[model samples]
Structure formats: C-alpha cells, structure tokens
Target: MAARGEVSTGVSADSEPEPGWLPDAAIVLSGGRGSRLGGTPKGRVRVGDIPLLDGVLDAVSAAGIQRAVVVGHPPSLERAGVVVTREDPPFAGPLAGVAAGLLALPDLPGKAWVMVLACDLPRAGEVIPLLLTGSPAEDDGAGVARERVQGADGWLVVDDAGRRQWLAGCYRIGPLRAACAAASTEGPDGLVGLPLRAAFGRLHLREVPDPHGASADVDTPEDLMRARAAARRSHRERMES
Candidate 1:
C-alpha cells in the first residue's frame, strides 16, 4: 500500500490472468459531489473495509494497467502507479474530470486504449475482463459468439437495466482526445457540466452487457448499503472457496 501522496506500482496478488488486450492507461472519474450521500465524497465511502476509490484503484491495478489518473479526492491508495488530480474549476462534471485525467497521463500512441472508470463501483474489477475481451454475446435463444468491434471507437458497458454506463467504458485514446477537444469548444463552460453522451456522440461504440451487475454504482445511502451487503457476500464466497 502507498502512503498518502506516494506512488505504488505493485499489482494485486490475487489478480486474475492478464487479458490478451489491455488498456495502456486508465482515467478514473471521482469528482462527483455526492449530494444524495449527504455531501460525503463517494470515493472515500467504504464498501466494506476498503474505500471505494481504493477498491477502484485495486481493480485498475489488477487489470495490469500501470498508468492511471484519478480525478478527484481519494484516500491514500495502496497502488504506486496511480496519479491523483482534479478537474479544473472544481466540481466540473465527469467530462471535465476525464479531460483532466487525459492531460495528467503521459503521451501514448493514438491506437492505445484507455479505460475510463467511475470510482463508485464495488465490482469494477469484474467488468474489466469483459470490456477487454469484447462485448458480451446477445441473450437471444440462439447461442452466439462474443465478437470484438474492429475499428470501433470504444466499448461501453450496458448495465443489467439496459442503460449505458459511459464512464465505465474503454476507449481508443485518439478518438477520446478528439472527442474531448470538440467537446471543449462546444460551450462557454468548455467541458464543465458537459454530459458524457454529447462528448462521445460521434464515435461508434460497442455495447458490452453487465450481466453480473458490475457497473452498479453507489449514489445514495440505500445504494451504499446494498454495495456493503454485496461486498460481504463476496467475502463470504471467497472464504468458503
């Protein structure tokens, strides 16, 4: 574990096998104003003993992504390679946070992909493999194969309720940069308060289904309780195994 403000490069000992494809960098959006949670920073909210932000960081590290920029306030993280930053003007929405995170990341090839994650998810690590591998097969009666979206701008996760979780997607860096640039010029606020849908509207995206509810995020006290319960269940399952 890293001390406050220190960097760590250690990978999770229990991390699953590395996928054939991995994002070169990750952008973690953590700047939301947890209004529903009584002004508490969601990143600092613990799902069990681990802070939500740390849990998200662990997921990123477990995926073998060395470079990550966390945009918002987060507790001291155990992983060394993670960078902590904030959106310009503070409280600027997730779009601004993504732009800030991109700026914080070292330059990489245009073809390199970046994982964009929101820091409120408890089971974020479980979805990484699904995003990396490709979209999940459609649930039609016929058995289908999971196919990668070639030349697509990115892969976005569709939660169990069929809503797209834009912040949980993996994207090609080039298109993402272009989208951010275009989005910055859209209004006087630049990326501030910009909706993620508008920013990535032009890019083609493959929808990956979240069958395991991995994209579920904490938004309220009730949500947090559910997350805590889920975490306890996971812990028990592990212990039993």
Candidate 2:
C-alpha cells in the first residue's frame, strides 16, 4: 500500500492484478455523528473485536483498491495507502463526507470507478464483491455481465427490505464528480446537509440485490449487538468448516 494521499501502482508485485471491472479507487464515508449509538464514532466502534473502520478498510484493500480516502477521524490514523480526512465543519452529512473523500482522492481517468462505502457496515467484506460483480442468483440470466450495462452511472445495493443503500454503491468517477458539483451549487452551505439521493438522483444507477442483508449498517445499540452476534456466528461457522 502507498502512503496517505499518494498514488500507487495499485497491484503489488506478489499479488494478482484486479479485474478490469473493479473500481480504481474508493471513498469511505465515516464522518457520521452516530447519534443513535450515544455519540460514539461509528468507525471506532468494535464489531466483534475489530474496529468498524479497520474492517471496512481491510475489505477495500482485499478488493485491490490501492487509492482510498477515509472521510472521518478514525482511531487508526496511519493506514497504508488510505488517506484520512474530515469533512468541512465535520459531521455535516454523508453527502459532505462523500465530497470530502472525493476531493481527497487523487485524480483518475474518466472511465475510472470509485466505490463509496460507509464505515459502520460489518458485512462490507461480503458486500463489496457483490457491488463489483452482480449476484448470479439475483441476475436475470445476464449474470455478472449485467454489471457492465452501457451508460449506467453505477450500481447501488438494494437491501433485502428494498431500500437503496446509497453509501454502499460503486460509481463512475465522472458522473459522481458531476453529481457533487451540482450538489455543491444547490446550497450556500455547499454539500453540507444535502441528501445523497438529491445529489445522485440524476445518474442512471442499476439496483443490485443484497441477498444476504450485506448492506445492513450499524446505527443503534441493537444494530451493533446484531452485527456482533452475526460476526460470532460467522467465526464459528468458519472454524467448523
């Protein structure tokens, strides 16, 4: 991994190169206030012994994304190749965090794609590959090829309950930058307090199904308990296997 805000060759010499369809970079939105969790920083909150932010970063690294910007003050500041930044005024909103992350990322080609993730998701490791490769079980016979649909701005995860998880999506950089620019103009406060849907509404996004509830995020204490329980169950299953 490269140093913070520095660009890298992406794949290490010992590692296999990522598929062409995978994202070139990532923007993690971790600056939320986590008010429901008694003001604890969601990124620092532990999901089974691991910090939520570290878990998310590990997933992103495993996905072969070398360039990433984490938008928030996480407990671990010096993640290799990942830049940590805070949104202006801090805790403005997810949209503001997205903007900050985007700004922090190094420039990429027009065709490049970036994964936008939230730090509170315990299942991010399982969720990311689904975002990059359309789920075979949910596809209409097109399989993973559905991910390359022409002119589509990106793919957003539709959780089991049918709600679109905007922060869990992967987007083409050009369209996302355009959306951010348009969003910035909408309010004197810039992207602050702007809803993600209002910013990204114009883009042509495909809905990918989250078959395993992988898009579930930790918000309240109950959500955290559920995540920890799920993590323990996964660990037990892996050990048995």
Candidate 3:
C-alpha cells in the first residue's frame, strides 16, 4: 500500500481487471470547513445552476447506485436522494466521515462494493465507472480474502497530473471497514484530522486513470469559476448534440 501522501507509480499493470459486480452504495464525504472558500460548504457552492452536492448525487444515481450516504449535514444533499448524516462532533474529517457512513449503513455486511467520493467535485460522478471497471484482478492472489489482505483492495483515481485522488474511488466494503477502523484510531477526533493518505495506507489499491479530469474539484473561488465555465461548456455541448 502507498504511504500517506505518497504518489504510487509501481502498482502492477496486471492488477487491472473487469468488475464482477456493480457498486451497492456510495459514501459521499461532505463535511469540510471549506476554509479556503471562506467557510462556505463546497457541496452547497454552485457551478452553474447545480450545487456541488447535487452534481455528485446525480452522478451516483447515474452510475446505478441505489443508496448513498452524504457524510455531512447539508439540507440540499438530503433532498438529493442521499441519506444525510454528519461525522460525530462535526467536521471530523473524511476518515471519520467514512466511519460514520459505515455505521449509518443498514446492511454493511451485505454490500460487496461501496463507492467513496468527495462532495466537492462537479464531475465526481463521471469517474465512478472507471473505478468500477478498474477493479483488482483475480490472479493477484489465490482467493479474494488473500488478495485483499495482501493489499489488493480497491480502485482509486489518479488524476491527469498524476496525483492520487483518494476520495474518488470504490472500495470493497469489508476491507474498507477494516481500513476505516484502523484510520479512525489514529487520532483523537476519530481520525478527524488525519490526512487521506494515512487511511489509504491501510488498503491495497489499484489506480484508475482519470483521463477526462473528472476528479477536478473546487477548493477556491478561482476553481469555482473554472468549474462553472466547464459546466457551461458541457451544457452547451449537450444541447448542441
């Protein structure tokens, strides 16, 4: 597994394999201070007419995900067909959000695959199929349990710039639960302040390339502007087609 914040370059090409099943649910992490955006929740921020949360939910829905947990308390997201919940103590970070998501699930044991995404990305939905398609190969080990335990767990997107987007991925539920458990114990806030890379260290990951930049997300006013412009362009293209 890759260390916290380390960009991995050596994940074997042989690990890529076709998905055997569709994702059962999604955990959309939405509880961030958006401190750079001056305390505005990124999920509530708009790129054109749609809030970021709506866009993410739309993508999740489009991917055929029946259930979704938005790990934040945005009224808009609750109305967007997601189960809205917040990390304990509020703003406990993405790892804690993951823990909350797992707990909120009614049948965590029944789910085989769960998509995990950040709420800030306008195009977050577009990358989900890529994650689903780039699952770990069966030959990686003799058994599913053996492969995952040996670190072949899930699929994460690597952006065009070659940075790993931890929030834009799909994970096997059992391994994800284990990883979240390990990650949540690393901090006082139930992994509230722990960086994503640390949590990622607990799993074996396969990198799915983000060829269309679908993992691009808003972190600042300038990013919002760009996202809106891109949304406009995409809308225009769709209308023209």
Highest TM-score against the true fold, candidate? 2
lDDT by residue (1-241, candidate 2, tens digit) is 3443333333322232234446678899888777889888999899979999999999988876777889988885787788888899888999888878877764675456788999998999988878766652545543444433455777788988889999998777777888888988989899889899867786888788887799899999999999999999999999999
Best by lDDT: 2
Better of 1 and 2 by lDDT: 2
As for candidate 2, its clashing pairs are: none
Q: Sort every candidate by lDDT, greatest first.
A: 2, 1, 3
Candidate 3 lDDT over 1-241, as tens digits, reads 4332222222232343223445667888888888898888878887869888888888777766667888886754344446888888797777778878888875656325677889898876577666644423443432222243234567688888989898888677777788777877777766767887767768877676677788888888898889999989989999999
**Cα error, candidate 1, residue 176 (Å):** 0.8
Which model is ahead, 1 or 3, in terms of TM-score? 1
Per-candidate TM equals: 0.85, 0.87, 0.80
Clashing pairs in 3: 92-192, 151-204
RMSD of each: 6.8, 5.3, 8.0
- Mark the regions of model 2 whose C-alpha exceeds 4 Å error after superposition: 1-20, 135-143, 146-148
TM-score of 3: 0.80
Error of 3 at 87 (Å): 0.5
